[model samples]
Target chain A: MSRIAITGIGIITPLGDTLTLNRQALQEGRSGLSSLEIFPTKYASLLPFGEIKITDKELKTRLDVTEPGVTRTTLLALHAFKQAVENCGLSASEIQLSETAFINGTTVGGMCLSDALYQDANFRETGSEYLNSYDLSSVTLYIQQRYGITGICNTFNTACSSSANAIMYGARLIQNGFVKRAIVGGADSLAKFTINGFNSLGILSSAPCRPFDNARSGLNLGEGAAFLVLEKEDNVIDKPVYAYVSGWANSNDAFHPSSLSDDGEGPYLAMQQALQVARISPKEISFINTHGTATENNDEKESIAMQRVFGNVPAFASTKSNIGHTLGAAGAVEAVFCLLNLIHDEVYASLNFDTPIEATGLVPVTEYKHMRVEHVMSNSFGFGGNCSSLIFSKGQKAQ
Target chain B: MFYIHQSSCISHQPTFTGVDLQNLQPSVNNQLPAIEPKYINIPLGQLRRMGRALRMGVGTGITLLEKHKADGILIATSNGGIEDSITFLNQIVDYNEGRLTPTHFVQSTFNAIAGLLGMITHNTGYNATHVHRGLAFENVALDVTMLLRENPGHIYLIGGVDEISVRNYRMEAMAGWYKKEPISNTELYASETEGALPGEGAAMFLVSNNAESATAKLADLKLLHTADENLVANQFAEFVRDREIDLLLSGESGDSRFKRYYTRCEQAVSENTAIARYKHFTGEFQTASALALWFSCWLLQNQTLPEHCIKRSGSKTAFNRIALYNNYQGVQHSFMLVESV
Candidate 1:
């Protein structure tokens, strides 16, 4: 089996853009939650979210996107991806472009553009030319065109598990000898469609979400993008490796369309497979980045899965409690956080974690702790009982 | 090798339970209503939550799961829940993009159907939903094959789904994806036209490492993304010839440009071999070729072909080797070879 290496990482979350900024926020237990003000919506006053402080114009100017009228999601992707591409310092034109696949995961592709057009008929007529730009394929097309990449391009949309699967697919493609390198990640911008959808489910917390806490309500919606440059160990020899995508697995509860199974079998099996693939025991996993949406059911079910897999719980936390759930971007964003933990040799405490669930006595890490973290497992479960787990191990020469 | 234990599809034709290729009836028009399932027995709450796409995905997924009790589920969709997506988008537009309905947002997701299937089957095993344009089904199928080959004790439920929406269809038509003149789907293969009728459906199969009850053993599957027609034809012919294929199920979507590749495939087959086309019945979409896979499994299990599938009436040879050739708009070419157990 071929080993997959993470050579580059980029993130644009509510916490901040750089890994250092994000780590600082994590250590300080700072919550990015604030009254929704980025986009003007009727629910703005009612729903608080982890809205980013940067403006679209600022992001576009910073990213240097030549195309005008791009969707916010695409802009976010470009901003973060450019940083990752530049951070690697590899000449884009020199790489084997045909062998490098672009795998993007997102829940909404340019729906923000459609939202703009739909709300204003005048804007619709004027922006009619941009309609083609709203198609999901346009995002990949833009990225491929900008980066001059001609290899396989795909957009994965499996809800929140979308990007985790993208990461897993990138690793598998390298292992399967289909591609030698890949740009894999996900992006999603806040839209009325997502905001309203959660509200209808009655899972949207008006206040800041307290994941795994007795007073926890639900998740605060957020938006951002994150990407990772993954390559085979042979392709990036002697390079400063970020982290190793050692093991990953995807599973489905097949329990309910919108909720997880009470038994937590889907998540449990996913974790088991990830650990098995890494050839490591549960005790070897030092920390976990949980898919703690702060929902009553999700917190409870995820706790049960943790207990079943580890017997004794490992130090774990939900960044969602701080930055809120970013939907399709959650997996990649959280993966970046996990990689940051491995690099910084630290564990982030779950913000707002006050009490353990009565059913499963799983207590999340409540404060930042300095630890020699070796292996960190991150979980992302989505609607329809889709569950995915990824294990990011500290960088080490391939065995 | 991964073996296909069972397969089912709910399309416009009466082919869900099983149909004879020779007895297939021609579609009167290009537009055919989907054949609704007998879901009166299904719970009301489940029914209420499901839209057309979700119903199609879960219905086929459940059918395959009930037959094989799979440990993993892998689904592929090109534009998952597009109908719901459009509805949600329109809602966002209607409310001046105000309070977005969470119901529509959740339903609008591309993996809505896969998630629903996972919930219904209680399958907490390996689960993934892939979307790769025309190669969506092929990618999912490849993953299933790989999983079955690597893991000794796993059964995978794999399926492909795509739903067409009015807005999407209109947009595609504007993009020159559809022909100006509407042609019946049943006559799609014989039309010699440049475009195929737009259609949507779902196909699911149970793939297992245990080949004890397999209808057909999947030998190999490959995907290529080259636009050079001649090279694609040569690679495809080499693949089939090397495998000693006895049958070919081509994804001739009634497009004139793509027909030449299928013609080359036919020329490569032996005089005693049989050939068939299935896109006429299933319509053209990213994963429509999955339906053709169901046909191959059916042929292997029943040892017969319906007249509607036959292009050239060759002698009935023993059904041992079969190959599936598929492509989308001259890209994402895929080849799959299967043999009787």
Candidate 2:
């Protein structure tokens, strides 16, 4: 199989708007979990959120978007998409080619404007601009419409693992000869719909989330977007390859809606299958970016899953502690973090970690350090037991 | 060759168990709802929790799984379980985000149907749901074909489902998604209108790479995202230039904005090439093409095209090849080719 190289990356998160900004924050170990800023809600000051500090207006203005029916979700996605395509130097014609596919992942589409939609749907006499943008396809549609993207476009909603699956599907499309290039990623924004939805599930923590910790309370909701420009290894000429997507897999627990199985069967299968695809052993893997959401079930199950895979675990950390679970964007954002690990030859610290879980007795890499990095595993487990893991190897010429 | 071994469809027509869409009476109500079967195997408690979309999707998907085991489950839904989502959102507003119920939120996610299928069938392999409007089913079908190519012997249960959310329907009416003055199914094509009649249904297919006793093979599928007039007029011709098309199942909603694309397809084909329209039998929705694929499979198995489906007479009497062309509001377009085993 020919390698699928990652030629470009674009990310916008609570930590920062640009990839460079986020890299610095990851090095400094700054936590982006603070109270909500742009969204006006009663829980704005009460609970912690990984809300992007920029207002909707600022985002729109920066993106030069003034179109109706465009939501904060679309704006976040467009921002990262533009940066990614630009960084990869894909022309408009190349992007519009039928061989160029656009696969997007988002759980929160236009629902970011749920309040506006509700206000217009019931009270107002006329329809609001947000009526068409409230579904899961709105963000991808907006990007497609704006760019006249005509290729195989798709929007996935596998709960939080949406974007990870998006990336995997893109690579599969390339490997299977469906498309030569794919722009794959996801974007989500802080919305009352999700906030209250998570709150109803009683998974929202008041304090900043501490993933992989013994006393980790719960996950803090976050919002962000990231896009990876993946091209068949043959086409990425003279481009600085951050990393190559070597292997990826998706496995379901089939256990519970919100929780994984007792021994993390989903995670174990996903990680094991991903390793088999990558053709690398556990000892060869330098770091594992765990999906430790700090929720009572996820962190422990994920730790146990790791133990089953690698008996003596390598340096592992969950950056969700730095920036709360970004739902759809977490996978791609953390994929970029993995690329950063490979490109910069370093691993960032997992913040707010005091002690390891008693059951696993495993401690994460607590301090940032330059290290020998070869292959990095990024894991993302979403609601509905959709567990996925992707392995990135140091880039080389296509075989 | 990728083949469909078994299938299930819950449409407005009674094609679930008896499988007789040919006898569907002519009534062109603007909104076409699925004539669902009695969900016998699904537990009543779980059914109570599911909204229309969830029940219909999971019901049909699980049925196919009961008959044959699949390596994966891929679902296509444009607006999945929207009513539940609306209910959850309304509750958040009504109760001021206070003491809210969690079931609605849990069941509202687009992939909830796929998740439920994994739990019930206990077949947890590659699970996915595609939510792109119009392209939902088509894209997922493409995904299934790719998965089959990657792993040669895998069978997948693929489905496309959607339910009418009264709130979303009403809201879409404001944007002219439905006709201002609705008409009956008999008068759908005759009555001049710019909008389509809202419709919803669920369709499931058991597709496998190893085709031994397959009903129909999905030979080729293509999409035309550009509404370029030149491309629309020429794409259908290009797909059928080599293959002898026995039937062309066209999804032409009565909306005239898209009538040109259908006309272009009709003009591209010969008079001997049989053409038929399906939306009149099953109203226009995002995943209606899935229903069309199901209908094509039925026609191949039964060796007959229902009288109501035929739009133009064709030369070939025996239908061995079928083509499906569908466009959603003249924006997203698809051209697919199917062959009988």
Candidate 3:
């Protein structure tokens, strides 16, 4: 099997919009959780979210989007997509090649404009502009059309583990010789649909989420987009490499629709299988970017999973404490953060973690420190008992 | 190559419980309802909470899994649980508060089918959901092909499910995706219609690398997107040029706008190749091509094509090889070949 390298990275999170800014914020242990301001909702004052502090119009202006029915989700996706393709400096011809593929992960898609869609369903004499944007693939289709990509395009929706699966699937395509290169990642925008959904589940926190903290009540919902350009080692030898996608595994808990099993069987199997695929022992994993959603079920279950996998957990942290849980984008966003960890040789703090859980007695890395990181494992567990883990190993530097 | 160990479909046709589809009638209503499966010992509480999409998907999924066990599960959905999602969104607007029901929200996700199937089957292996508009089923097929290549000899249960709702149907109707005039299903192809009749259903396949117990062999498949008829013709020629095709199953959804693409396909194949259509029976959705695959397997297994689906009969009586070609609104095109074991 050929090695897959992460040649380009792009992100638009609450911490910062650019890669440099996000890395700097991570180094400084800064939190982006704040009260929702741009969008109005009943929980605006009560809940904190990692909202990307930019207005839709401003984002449109920045991305030069003039389309009529573009959703906020599409804008965020376009922003990150542009940065990723440009980061790799891929030419237009390269992007339009049939050998290339674009695999995007998203939960919201155009459904964020639910109110408009509802009206279009009720009173519209003609078709509403939002009609074409309601499905989950609309964002990806929009990007494909904008870039004139003729290759195979797909959209995945496995909840929080969606993007991680996208990355995994992309690598499989290359490894299997289905495609030469694939641009894979996910994006999600804040909307009333998710807010109401998470609120109904009673998992939305009123303050910044406290991952792995004993007093942690629930998770804070957030929104962002992240994409990584993945290419075969041979295809990207001339370009700069950020990290190598060494291993990935996806497993289901077969337990619950919205919560994980008590023993963390899903997370355990995912991490164990990922390590097995990487051909590395548990102790070889340097750090872990955990899927610490700060929920009553997720944190403790993830802690138990870590213990089951490594016996002694590595220096792991949940960037969710900094950027809240980004839903479908959590995987790719955290993957980028893990790459940052490998690139900078530093471990970012899992903010708001004051105490460890009683059952597992596991505490995350709470302070930023320079560590000789080699292999970092990133976990993304989603609703429907979907759990996925990706192992990104540090690539050899150009001496 | 992938081998189909077991297959199940819950569609408008009488496909459940291994029933014969000879008595199927031409549908008149724009919306064709799928036949609900009879659940035996499964949990009723969980089934009751599921929407039509989840029920159809899990119903067919469990059916296939019970017959042929699988280690991995992959599902494809186009719109996916639109009824539940629209209902949930409506509730949010109606109440406009944080206090709302969680069931609809829980089931509104696109992966609801895959997740529910995982929970029900207790298969903790690879699980994924693909939601690429018209290429949903094609993408799932591609993923399964790659997966079987990597882990040769592993069994995988892959499926495609899409549910239709009034809210979503209305949006599509407003967008003019459906025909304005309701024509008889039998007359769909002859009516010179501009849009297709909306439909939804679920189909599951138990695939494996082992061919010892295979019912039919999946030869190969291709997916493309273009508006050029000549390019489609060339691709179709390349796909069928090497194989001695006995029957050609074309996705002629009765929409004249995309009729040229199918016409190009018809021109690409040999004159003796039998032609058939299924959109009139299964209606049209993103993954309706799955229904085509199921139809192709049925033809190869039974060695005959139902008269209703036959557009042009050929002299070949022995159905050894069947090819499926699907075109979605002239944007997404896919080709799959299935042959008898």
Give TM-scores of chain A for all candidates. Answer: 0.95, 0.98, 0.98
**Residue by residue across B1-341, what tens digits does model 3's lDDT show?**
69987889988888877656665656757666777777663579988888889888988898888876688899999877889998898888878764998999998788888988899888898899999988988899999998898789899999898987888889888777888896777788886868888888898999987889788888888888666788888999999997888888989998889998888888877888889888888888888988778777777778767778889997787888888889887778888988889
Instruction: Compose the digit string of candidate 2's lDDT tens values, residues B233-290.
Output: 7877898787778888889898878888888887777778898888877888899999
Give the per-residue Cα lDDT of candidate 2 at A116: 84
- What would the per-residue lDDT of candidate 1 be over residues B1-341, giving only the tens digit for each residue? 58887787877677666553565545545644446586543457777766676777778777777666777778888778776777776766666655554665676577777676666665667777777767778778767766765677788888888876666666555544665577766667777666777777888888887768778887877776666678777877788765566678888888887888778767777777788777777777877877778778878878776777777756656678888888887756788888899
Model 2 chain B poorest 10 in a row by lDDT = B21-30
- What is residue A342's positional error in candidate 3, in angstroms? 0.7
TM-score of 2: 0.98
- All candidates: CA RMSD in angstroms? 3.8, 1.5, 1.3
Error of 3 at B210 (Å): 0.9
Candidate 3 Cα misplacement greater than 4 A, ranges: none
- Write model 3 residue lDDT over A313-380, tens digit each, in one string: 88999999999888888899999999999998999999988877988889899999999999999999
Q: DockQ of candidate 3? A: 0.80
lDDT (Cα) of model 3: 0.88
- Show the colliding residue pairs in model 2: B28-B184, B28-B185, B272-B314, B272-B315
Instruction: Give per-model TM-scores.
Output: 0.88, 0.98, 0.98
Q: Candidate 2 at residue B31, lDDT?
A: 81
Q: How many clashes show up per model? A: 21, 4, 0
lDDT of 2 by residue, A1-399 (tens): 679999879999988988899999999989888887678877999988888888888989999998888898899999999999998888999888889999999898888887887875566667888777888788998899789888899989888899999999999999989899999999998888889998898888889888889999899989999999999987877778879999899988888888888899989999999999899998999999889899989999998999999999899999898889889888888898899899888999998899889898889999999998999999999887899999998865333
User: Which stretch of 10 consecutive residues in model 3 chain A shows the poorest summed lDDT?
Assistant: A117-126
